[model samples]
Target: MSDNKSNLTEYLTPLIPLAPVLSVKSLSFVTSKTKKQQSILGCSNKLQLTSGRAAIAIALEHAGIAKNDEVLVPAYHCESMISPVHWRNATPVFYKININTSINVDNIILNITPKTKAIIVTHYFGFLQELTSIRAVCNEHNIILIEDCAHAFFGSLNNQVVGSIGDYAIASSMKFFPCYDGGILASSTRPLGNVNLKKPTLIFQIKAFFNIIERAIYYKRFGIAGKGINALLKVKEWLWNNIKSVSGEHYTCNSPASSDGGYGLEEDWIHKSTSVASNLIIKQSNTKLIIEKRVENYQKIHEALSGLTTAHPLFTKIENGFVPLVFPLYVDAPEQSFDVLKKQGIPIWRFGEYLDKQITEAFCPNSTALSAHVFQFPCHQELTNQELNWMIITIKKTIK
Candidate 1:
């Protein structure tokens, strides 16, 4: 048994994740000589594509969604998330996000009409919940279920990962581990339909390449360039909104290439993963070890601030080793708390604005209340303990 175990360990060692693709430190270069080694070869029983968005679009298209089908979607998602269903000529039935947990789809199920064909579930901000009830409902109704694991990877309930439980699973690789752009669509019930992988046009490819380079440069010099770009974009937006007549060239400026920072048209699939993303994955380095550290810091902060302030951990108990995408703090007086925090240089946010509409009426009251009053603080992998301590001190000083 010992010899067999050793052999198994040796064989599986290379397959384990090495490191996070995006890091605060200079771990690898985009033009590194060893970058190309990470490209996947041949297809699997599952479909893997150049980008997560494209993968979801293709999966939905293959699922027989016609022009009149109604696809239920989480209202809290970005506009870009609904493109797949729209591309299939389907109507987007907006559903409310459960605020308290950011996991349940109570709002969506209640609003389901006869036209509803599928439900897209986002494991919001990495919080996993008991989905047995939701799955049971879908099974009973015969509605196709698609798990959107864009913010969640490897999260499980009752020994089943989110991706494995649904009729189909859509995962955005870039969101989790820093791959440039890629998605996985896997199905057990229905064989994924045959389809050709279309490469973005060459011009789009070249433009996207440059945009990636530009972003890298911007992020690397975030102290200056990041701020400058943000300020300039803000000013541009202000001008466009206030001076509509002068914005007559809006159509020209809003063309695809200009809007997307010169990315190529959406027809090519070069299948080239970014060097930065690949190197981060292959080196199996300790860059993401920072997330573990952040989790520890969050525990200390939560314990210290739990009763003194309204902020709380949404999960029953934050799962061990899971990185937090945001630390949500519910305040008694959101405006007051926000003002106090802002005066102290602590940036806080309320994120569920998209769920305030008609369809959102179906969302949980607890979620809605929390969403309206909660302020999210940065808990990204790179945050330092000292920074967290300072933030806590500032919050206490200002709130009281």
Candidate 2:
């Protein structure tokens, strides 16, 4: 809930990044400040929050989910998704997903009860799931659909952008944009009541902006700019030590604040709005190149990894409306390669890795299999040619 200053070594970034890392040059693409961007920010009936889980919590509240109500959540999910249901005091009935991780509509139908009031469907890896059947089923049962678009903030299906199709939808802007903190709750079908929020304190706001620059330098992102930041950081360190020696003050966080999204829902920041800096970045930045570059990078991985014996892509084709958040790959043996790939500094993540204990292999076979095998690699707009090539080569080498 505090600053998302993950220690320099978290999987968030390998020696290379697994997601978008901002640099000074990253802002150059923000061509217009005043023009209304055609992205999700342009949508009406949307509320911004500090993180995606916060939006999920709000979606639960606004969907009229009360205590002990059952909300259909995928068996394969991070704690972020599960925690919000707990926060609402509602039971999360873990539904089985199809092999590709789409909702198993029959499972949903089987699981529904009078207490079941809603269903949450994720647009996994930015590939939109075919939701027409799910929508109809929800309508027939009168269950609200909470579309989770954390991996998908852009692109469209049936001529309507994502996050607008469901009765309620939420997105994680930090994944798509260069900013540190942002999430959106949007609905086209229902008018969203305004979520009153107090601005973050000036110091926190400053840190929110600075954390972007610091994270880039932490990952050694820009060629020369990163090095320059490293040099200045050395000077600052020296000055700080000298000052500490003189003032007899040395601060230490035995446990620095961690866990921004996945650990659990933080009620403290749920009411807080996005910082001013991130809101500006979200609104000003153009996404045309961002989308095109993401698609291009995803295409490269699909073409290169299609032939791998040890690993294969989860989605074979980047469908017309698909915009990827990461290259979702299923390696044959995570026990053999997961740690090795991490040690090799491959920018990879497996959202389904630390799934809830209640979700057993016997309970949900596809979720169990997908949880162990499916790994996500960076396919963000900020990926460099070298990083892309290196990750591809490393993954191929490590797995095979």
Candidate 3:
């Protein structure tokens, strides 16, 4: 990264997250759901883990991917998606995506070799896409199809759900629900068989639950409880600092790398089960309301931006039988507008901003252009009208 861009990133980070955090308002939304939530996990064979990348690792392991095997991954991807391939000591061959971010089947076919063991298809931004053609190619080549649904937990196409069409599917529950962390590995065509998982300790479980509420409070999303959480946090910080000072122990936020947390996958936490709190929240989350609110927010943002000259919606309209994770808009001269929007504290992100070193602009023009120009804005269920407008209005002012 250029020194200027690196400095900007360091100084201007998003105060809020891309995912929904637990708040009193979100809790109320959860209780309103009466139906047992429906999702891709209704499949017969499924396992819950600490994070989506862990599910990916388990998927690769179960598929018998090992050292020297080659996996086909999209050129446009987050590190988490690519890390699992490396974790298995496998090489990932990059494939291109369409300008719309859909998989380029031609690239997939051209890159295939006898060493190709698996191909991962991501349902980018919760857009439900039919996998019939891709599945046909996978079958012809005897390649395992791994569906990456990190951005989408619910959706269907042609009577098949998002995760069911592939040999294995992975979902990041925390992104869709107001939970701390959770992920699921599932398959409809094959049995996951049996694998042991170590339960998280009681202390970790307790903190995981409270941390969600704490995050919400920090964002002032907890209404009247926000002040109380802040006050208690101040007192806690004071006591912690004084105690550490007296003991001559330096304070640090550093923790050992675990598969249960952080960006890259850690082998140690691969077998760790999702925290009880995350599972409970996932179970009780208002699936119906989530779909409803997300669709509403997505359409609203699209409508607001439809008239803008500087940017345009990636998908002219939301697809049927699906909900959106975020409102993706393509802005012209992102070099000019992207940082301006970020400096204004917009909860926006470019998924493939920093891809594998092997990936280049010449190698994947669409991915490179996207990483530079496409910005994703949150459209989660928890966003209020005022909050949504703040984002939309700020985007308009800056993008102009």
Candidate 4:
């Protein structure tokens, strides 16, 4: 192993001795006031499952968006977000991103026609977008505002949650929370009232159950799993391609998000605060130790890379609660840096690399720039100090 890898292994190996092994019994929790309190705070009554598209579907319906309506979306989002607009028979008007990597839409709004009904603003990478300005513009035009809180679960801007600012907000519980799957569509100003859920297909429920089992097994064997999932996904893709039609619409804030209760839950597709996820959310919510460690590691990595010519942090540190998803480094030449890091056995990712570059030409200049320039290092809760140091050293050595 390289010195950095060896150092990381040695550092983590000792922690394994001190750490308690995960047991099925320990995973179980006793009923308590704290647990009950968590359920109340976490939108326990409001969350539901869609085939993973509940958020957008709810937003589209609440906004009264109709066929051929246009909804503006950030050019820098996952392709899944656009599926709702297409499913609704509406068009997506792409908007550019600013240098700060926040949504920029001055040009997009100028081009907005009578068909434009709403805009979906994403708080990318947990950084709260400048929604105050966007809300102001939307109000003037009598356009609805939808906040994509998929990446901003606990994130807030100026003491207001991202989901609270807009006319409607949607979030996926699986992204930030420890839950396997679920999404929430919430409103503050308007009443969502009660939504009736359609029964999910039996095949989807079976597949979701097996997929969870497979993911658990892979995690146990490989430390960080999902390789088996990719193989399974390929087979699924092939089958889907041969098939002519699939029941139910794709999940989105604009459409009624579809749900097949994930894995075990068949009766309800929405996330009911399970004893398992409730505890995990509580544990992670007040994660002072994890957050501090990550912040420290981020500082070290930033300090070390600040001197490098091609590597630099993406945002200012002074922003309110600007916790990083990972320590991001923007390289002038990404493919070269990626190869150099890979050769050294460091795992890295070109975050959101799958975004449609061609469609981006409509708006999103900064999103396009970031797509080619930035790479993420793993800074999830499991990271250790040794791993952080090794990562810093690896970056210092790899970057010219």
Q: Which numbered prediction scores highest in lDDT against the true structure?
A: 3
- What TM-score does each of the candidates earn? 0.63, 0.88, 0.89, 0.67
- Order of all candidates by TM-score, from best down to worst? 3, 2, 4, 1
Candidate 3 residue spans exceeding 4 A from truth: 1-17, 29-38, 229-262
lDDT of 1 at 264: 24
List per-prediction Cα lDDT, in the order shown.
0.53, 0.79, 0.80, 0.56
Candidates 2 and 3, the one with greater TM-score: 3
Task: Provide the RMSD of all predictions against the true structure, rounded to 1 decimal.
Answer: 12.9, 3.8, 3.3, 10.1
The runs of at least 3 residues in candidate 2 whose Cα sits more than 4 Å from the true structure, single-residue gaps closed, are 1-13, 29-39, 225-262
Write model 1 residue lDDT over 306-357, tens digit each, in one string: 7664455555456753444456666776766665555455645354533425
- Candidate 2 clashing pairs, residues 3+ apart or interchain: none
Give candidate 4's TM-score.
0.67
Question: 2 or 4, which is superior by TM-score?
Answer: 2
lDDT of 3 by residue, 285-362 (tens): 767878888899999999999898888998888877777888889988788886677787787757777777877888
Measured with C-alpha atoms, the lDDT of residue 154 in candidate 2 is 83
Query: Candidate 2's C-alpha lDDT?
Result: 0.79
- Selected candidate, larger TM-score, 3 vs 4: 3
Model number with the top TM-score: 3
Can you tell me which runs of candidate 1 are displaced by over 4 Å?
A: 1-21, 24-55, 75-78, 81-83, 94-99, 102-113, 178-195, 199-294, 320-323, 337-350, 359-364, 390-400
Give the per-residue lDDT of model 2 (tens digit) for 1-400. Answer: 1111233354433667666777654566565542333345556788877778888888888888889899999998877888889999999998999888778889889999999998999998898877899999999999999989988988777776777668888888888888778888888777777556666667567667767767788776776878887788778769868988999986541110121333666677777788888888777656776787899999999899999997899887898877888888988887898777777777666776777898888999898898888888888888889888998898888888
Under the 3 Å rule for N, CA and C atoms, how many clashes does model 2 have? 0
